[model samples]
Target: MKIPFSLPVIDADVIAEMHDTLTNTGWLTSGPKVQALEKELELFIGGGNALCVNSWTSGAMLVLRWFGVGPGDEVIIPSYTYSATALCVMNLGATPVMVDVKEDLTIDANKMRMAVTSKTKAVIPVDLGGYPCDYDAIKEVVNAPEIKELFISDNEKQEMLGRILILSDSAHSLGATYKGVPCGLVSDVTVFSFHSVKNITTGEGGGIVVNLPEPFDNAKELAFLRVLSLNGQNKSAFEKNQIGGWKYDIIDQGLKINMPDLCATVGLAQIRKYKNELLPDRKKIYNYYVDALSSYNWAIIPPFKEGSTESSYHLFLLRISDISEEQRDEMIRVISEKEVGVNVHYIPMPMLTLFKNKGYKMADYPVTYDLYKNEISLPVYNGLTEEKLHFVVDTVVAAYKTISGN
Candidate 1:
């Protein structure tokens, strides 16, 4: 039996809705479906304005651009995160200061604080493997007096200038919670991915949730920025159909990154069915893996903190104890041979050629390297049947035993 690593859950309802949306609506790009999806997402994630985009990378770029994080600015990010996290900063001609990860594989808040300087503008903390980072701790460090003094020269301006924005990469944690507050509301700006492989599928889509500090008309600002980000157009395709609304302006040079209605149609259906219908299945598979793999002395299960009831359960990352990177790779190969699909979460950013060429050193991010060497992402999707789940778990155990020569 072949057990796939990840499979998206799509139902007849989703297909029917998508077909109706495509057939009934002539305007596919940024139409009623997109608007409806955004509104529904806002309600689902509690209160905060959401701007749907073509991809999470584009959303991150737009957020960074909106915050005036450009040339000569630096954004601190975890070394263990996806390349897009740092790529967004580099794309803006800003420096990406890679920091170490904690034992749990989230960004090290202390190291993040240490990485801050006069040029430091924001910190992008990733919810690695759907585990929530200590946002309160990160906020405290970002708001420290000493750190503030270094960034803000004037005592009066310290409050405003010294503050570092928390741009959460919540691509893996759409339904996750931190101390009763949803992930969308926990950060200054949170970006979520709706890729085919994500907990929620929209084929390939993402959105940005803005939780602004002041009452700056976030809805209006987000709407305008989204329009500008897509094509620098003053009016969207929807607005063009309005009587005498075709006349619009191009404010700034921007990229084409708007989410289409087709994608939004799928997203809307997923949001409605996610919590009650899909999440439980994912949790069941995760619990089964945890229970089956617990007895292995070499396996370290993913962390689940107390009171985190709404975890997205995006990936089940397991760490191998006392194993070299080569042995870990070999273990994954062995698992594949057994027809159990397993993959590594990521390689540290510094190890990549692009980052290494930019003078990023792997030696500076020891903790992230340690985690990367031992980590393997197991299958945990909504459609895993009982037979497939058992096969995956048993195959994992067998691979570990074979690699350890037990």
Candidate 2:
């Protein structure tokens, strides 16, 4: 039986919604469905204003750009995350300072605090594999007087945070929580991905959640981001469709990255079933793997539930204890040969050619390197059955033993 790493969960309801959206909605790009999705997400998350976008990359870019993180400014990020976390900073002419993450794969708060300088404009803590970073601890560090004094404020956004902006790279953690609060509400700003591999999908989409506390108006921030998402147009296509609303103004030189109604259709459908079916099913599969693999002393299962926060159970980041990098690769190969697919979450940014050429050294981040060497992301999706879950665990255990010559 061939069990692939991950698959999108789409049922008849999703298909029917997309069909209805296409057939009924005349204003396709950023129309009623998109507006409805924004509202629905806001309600689902319990607070914060939601802005849907074409991708998490673009949503992050918008946040950095809005915060005036540009030329000579430094944005700190975990070295273990996808390159987009660093690349977004680079695209804005800002420098990305790669930092090490903790054993749990979240960004280290102490390292993050120490990394802050007068030039540091923001710090993006990635929720890798749908597990939230320790936002409470990170917040205390951000709020520290010493760190607060180093902030260089040039805009309203910078003024509000009073220090480095904590923009959460929550691409893997939409339904997650941190300290009992929803993922979106924990950070000053949070970005979530709705890509096909994610727990919820719009084929390809993302969302920005504004948690910037009042005195800072979230609605105004949402409007500003909407302008930035649509090539700086004062009015969107849907707005312009209104009678005598054709005339509009170009406010800022923004890029085009708004989520269309077609994507929103899927998002709307998915959000409805997310809590009741999607999350619960994924949790079951995650537990199944945990139960099946618990006896293996070599297996280091990821923590989905810790304290009050719970992961969305998106990716199962399993690590092989005492296994060398070479042996881990061989294990993956053997598992694939047996028709059980396996994959890695990431290769550290400093190890990548792009960031390496830019003068980053992997040697600086020992923990990130160690985590990457043995980490494997197992398949955990909505449609995965108990049988496939058991098969995957059995295959992985056998492959590891075989590769280790045990």
Candidate 3:
């Protein structure tokens, strides 16, 4: 038996909803189903307006572009994140300023505060492995009078925001919280990836939660992003079909990244169950891992909960003390040989060729490097059986022993 790192929840409701969508709904691409999903997510996020996009990259790009992030601008991001966090910045012709992370694997808010310059338009705090970054600290940094004074507004949105926009890279933390506030409402804006590997999925889709402050209407911003995702067309095909609605205007040169109704159906089914079922289930698995590994001398348990912040329990990131990167890799190899699959959360951004060529170095980010060198992400998904869980725990311990020659 093999255990994969992640799997999407596709239950009877998902299939039923998807079937109804394929046959019942007259539309497929970005219609009422997608609208329903947006509304549900909006409510799920507590107060923010949620916009469904084709992917996390597209949603993030749309938000960045809307904020006028372009040439000569810098978007600060943690080096310990998936490439999407940085790629979205590069796509907008803005520079992604690499920063080290805290032990929690979240961006260090103070480091970001120090990294700010006149060119700094945004600071993307990545909730890597579902653990939220220090939002209150970041809020203080962005809201400081001096920091606000340093902000150079390039557009109406920027001028309204008056400081660095906290666009959270929350791809792994949709249901997570920072100080009891949900991930969606924790930042100026939060983008959630509904990928196949995520806790909640829409096959390949994303949700952009808008929580921008006053003078910036979130509802209006939602409308703008919705149109922006639909190739700048103020009206969708469904709307165009209505009487005297054929006349539509191209607001701007926008992207075609709207989530389809077909995909939205799956997301809708998943989101409804997330709070009551999915999230809690993942938490159970997370607790079990911690309880099992706590007694071991070599086991360095990942930060699942630190103070008020709580994870979505997306990835069970386990670390081993006093191990080289080679030894860590060997552990994964040995574990996989036992048919227990595992993975590493990330290779720091500076270690990648794309950022390395841009003069960013891994040595510059000691904290990110320290965590990355020994981290191993274990499987945490729905339907992982008790026997499989036991097998996984045993397999990891056995692999560690093999690597250490113990």
lDDT per residue for candidate 3 within 1-406, as digits (tens), equals: 7888777888899999998898998788888999899888988878888889999999999999889899899999998999989999999999999888998888898888889999999999888889888888989999999999999988888888888999998999988888888889988899999998998899999999999889998889989988888889999988997788899999988999989898999999989988999889999998989999999999998877867778999999899999999999999999989878799989888998988888998888999999999999999998888888889999999999899989
Q: What is candidate 1's lDDT per residue for 106-186, written digit by digit as tens?
A: 888988888899888889999988889999899998778887666633232224444777899999998888888888999
Q: Rank the candidates by lDDT, best first.
A: 3, 2, 1
- TM-score, candidate 3, is 0.98
Against the true structure, candidate 1 reaches a TM-score of 0.95
lDDT for residue 309 in candidate 3, whole number 0-100: 78
Comparing 1 and 2 on TM-score, the stronger one: 2
> Model 1 shows how many backbone clashes?
0
Cα lDDT, all candidates: 0.85, 0.90, 0.90
TM-scores of all models?
Answer: 0.95, 0.98, 0.98
Q: Once all C-alphas are superposed, what RMSD does model 1 give against the true structure?
A: 2.3
Off by over 4 Å in 1: 152-162
* Candidate with better lDDT, 1 vs 3: 3
Q: Stretches of candidate 2 above 4 Å error?
A: none
lDDT of 2: 0.90
